[model samples]
Target: MRSVGKQLDITIHRPEELSVPLRRAWHEAMDESPDYANPFLAPEFAAGIGRHRGGAQVAVLYEGREPVGFFPYERNSFGVGRAIGLGLSDCQALVHRPGVVWDMQELLRACGLSVLEFDHLVDEQKPFGRFVTGTFASPVVDLKDGAGAYADWLRSTYPGVAKTTLKKERRLGRDVGDVRFVFDERDPRMLHRLMEWKSAQYRRTGRMDRFSRPWIVDLVDHFFQVREEHFTGVLSVLYAGDRPVAAHFGPRSRTVFAAWFTTYDPELRYYSPGLMMHLHMAHAAGGHGVRLMDFGRGDKEYKDWLKTRELRVGEGFATRPHPVAAAHRLWRRPVRGLRNTVLAHPALREPADRLLKSVGTLRTSGRTGLERPAPRTR
Candidate 1:
């Protein structure tokens, strides 16, 4: 614990230990800024991560004994820390009141973190902006008024894509069955099915399977049961009559929806069920009071087609002068650079994506051993 100039107090505690008053204060602070309004910044998300990850902690900042800010992170034994739910969370920031300010170095010292890394930090964080290595455009959907207006705007903006999508939706309904969408599904079975589909998609894309990890699996399970005013695990599913075709699971606050895990059955890929699912979600979410849908940091054609605007997010490491920090940065910077370069250019990106797909195919084939089965010793 440390006091900043006798006017502010910083205390670190386990995420679950945050009192209701503190949580309420945190919510109030979030409402003060659009940057912090993301559900990923909510205390409920921190508490959910804390349940599965032992190192999760929150540093609460108090001004005159009233909670004004909250910083959630996970620190390892080596004093290396990261934003809470770092890999999964798309928006990162210290949720603070409008007039509250704190010294970054002192805050890090008080929390006992020698180095902290963040990839999706909000742009308004000037306190940590000096340490940023790079910035990326995180696309988002700006829903004006409600779903119907946005759909009309979409049709007016991209008539071809909008017309084609709607035509496909009708065809899908006619062929598969009556297509129905449930915005806030409570069935746990659908959640498991989403995870399974996501895991397969990860394998098929040569990406790390988050669902394979026990901690992440448990974290999702815990968050699924969390139903609160500020944070709720929203499960939106697109069903063909009775069969689920596409589904999405993410956290939602009063105004912001973080697009997290979404997957569709491969059989329905031709129908673009994933896109339809998002369209329906955006419509339903707008009716439910959500204003912004964060599509997260990535470059995809679909994201480009759907996004009305973009937000800037930073990626960098804030560290005390240490040999470990230097080494970590040296090793990590180039890999990120290479990936970003590939993603930024279509010529390079197309080849890189194909290579990754080939590698994924080989990896999946090797694991199955179907290509080289042993023969009987007759």
Candidate 2:
């Protein structure tokens, strides 16, 4: 038995190997902690990642007969570990009961990891706070009665936005066909289209195209097939007549709808379809009982306009005393520091953005034969 301090028993298992009672306990922990409400923190998401990632593991912390916490991570052969689905997952958390804290060194030892790396860690994780190297603002929209309620809030929050958006919607319908918004589209074809748009968007922005990887593609498809109440793959589309102008695919817990993969047709950029889709999505999601829409962590003008508030998230490496841990932190910290510096300074960021666009133009010309700037999917 792997026993940690505070009389906790730690058991490591593949996520799929978790017993029904343990999964239920995991769900209960999520319900008990507001910070763990993100779908990324759920056992279902860990299980999904485990299906695709061979290294995926979950450590269940038990106090006698009761399970009290769940830690999901991916461990490599060198004893290095990372929060499961690190790059793609917008939220990273150790779901646990209130007041239940673990010793970092003991936890890492129990899991057979020298270091645990994470980004987008929820702020309320007090045990991990000391390890945090940086913190960022994660914007979110508070939902209420329905779309109409949000529209009013948006109008008041961003003066003249409602009028401008309405005018654009009218023009779009007139130019195209009757505009339509689907909150939970089930069509496989539409999902494929969204991935295509997202891939092109990444290429056009000089960003790594995640969909280009087979495993990433398969993971997305797997998520699309998931239909649990605690975790559902939601595909929202904004259609101009029979043609889809913009689409978004993301997971939602019962109350939180995370804004994930979103992309729009390049030709429809003039209508600002990306922004339009977001507005409509908020309305529909609110009507569907969603109380919060998390925009993830990013510094975008649209997030500033659309958000009701911001949640703080952290990035860091939680390490035990080990040579491997030291080496891993040394190699990774500088890279993260430089990138954060570039992103934090506008003078540096603008020039970098322009350079990316210029490179994007050349790449798009040589690759996709489609070359034009479109609004980003926030």
Candidate 3:
């Protein structure tokens, strides 16, 4: 990509064609940011997606022969191209140098996308012209310095809740066997068990089991083995006596732990093992010098009770450069409108949830094939 004056010259390239300089520039810029700074936006993730799904595109934004930004997205075509695999991620955006700015509309136009959809985009990006929707509350726990300070902060902020949870922990130890917590469990076997538990949870709730997708399952397995400072797989398990009661698996940065998947043994429900695990994770994260625990986008009573603040994320589409792009937008208008209408009514939410549950059940049960075995230990 070439540049003219102050505006960047943006060009769309296949993931394999991304220049080394451009990739380096993107990571360097993203590293300096204090936000989630998720490595999912990095080239490694791009490559992983490319391996799982073809047509992964990397948009290079440049000015005066200098690489400035990178936008990595998958290209989906159903008449027109859309952003690849957007709905499942927590961080989305172009990785750009600090203080560098560009028009998102211009970039999207250049990349030939018909719609640029994002569900977990950071709050700072200004390219999308409209605010599409807001996710439920995302709970975050500060983990600056070490776990001790965070524990003190928790004691001060939610004294009763903290006391109660801690008491439960002690009681669980007395009633059950020894209580043990594993921060970064490396056993792939354990990961498989976590997936099995999560899938079972989804089935019990009549929700879609994401683990059914081979690509997603492979992605999680690949990420679990990946151990980088910025983006590492974190699997925390709480064991009572010799049996595992609760576990959580997700990605973590130096200062942020994104809570992705969580489940607990139903037999130990009285101990509130899930909540106890989070309490332990909070302390562990703080001790590790991390600063935030993102519970992802969802409105749960637990999130509200645990989190001290919230971050806003917006969603919308960016069209491709093709002629059909306009038609795609026009076609999506009604769907967007209906979605907004549903979101506006609290009364309709329960019915919508039920419908989603039904769809999930059908989707999971419809799958017919030999699948991998569940993990023995998690």
Judging by lDDT against the true structure, name the best candidate.
Answer: 2
Writing each residue's lDDT as its tens digit, candidate 1 over 127-201 gives 897889899999999765454664575486557688888788788888888888899999988988898888777
TM-score against native, each model: 0.93, 0.94, 0.83
* Candidate 1 CA-lDDT value: 0.85
Reference-based TM-score, model 2: 0.94
What is the lDDT for 241 in model 1?
Answer: 86
Off by more than 4 A, model 1: 145-158, 366-378
lDDT of 2 by residue, 1-378 (tens): 599996898989999789999988998988887788888888889999999899999999988978999999999999999999999899998899998878888999999999999989999888897899999999999987574554475576456578898788889999998888899999978888898898888877877778777777778888899998778889999999999999999999988999999899999899999889888888888888989999999888878889999999999999988999999999999999998999899999999998887777777778655443432221
Number of the top TM-score candidate: 2
Cα lDDT tens digits, model 3, 310-355, are 8776566655455576676677766866875676676886788787
Model 2, residue 107: distance off in Å is 0.3
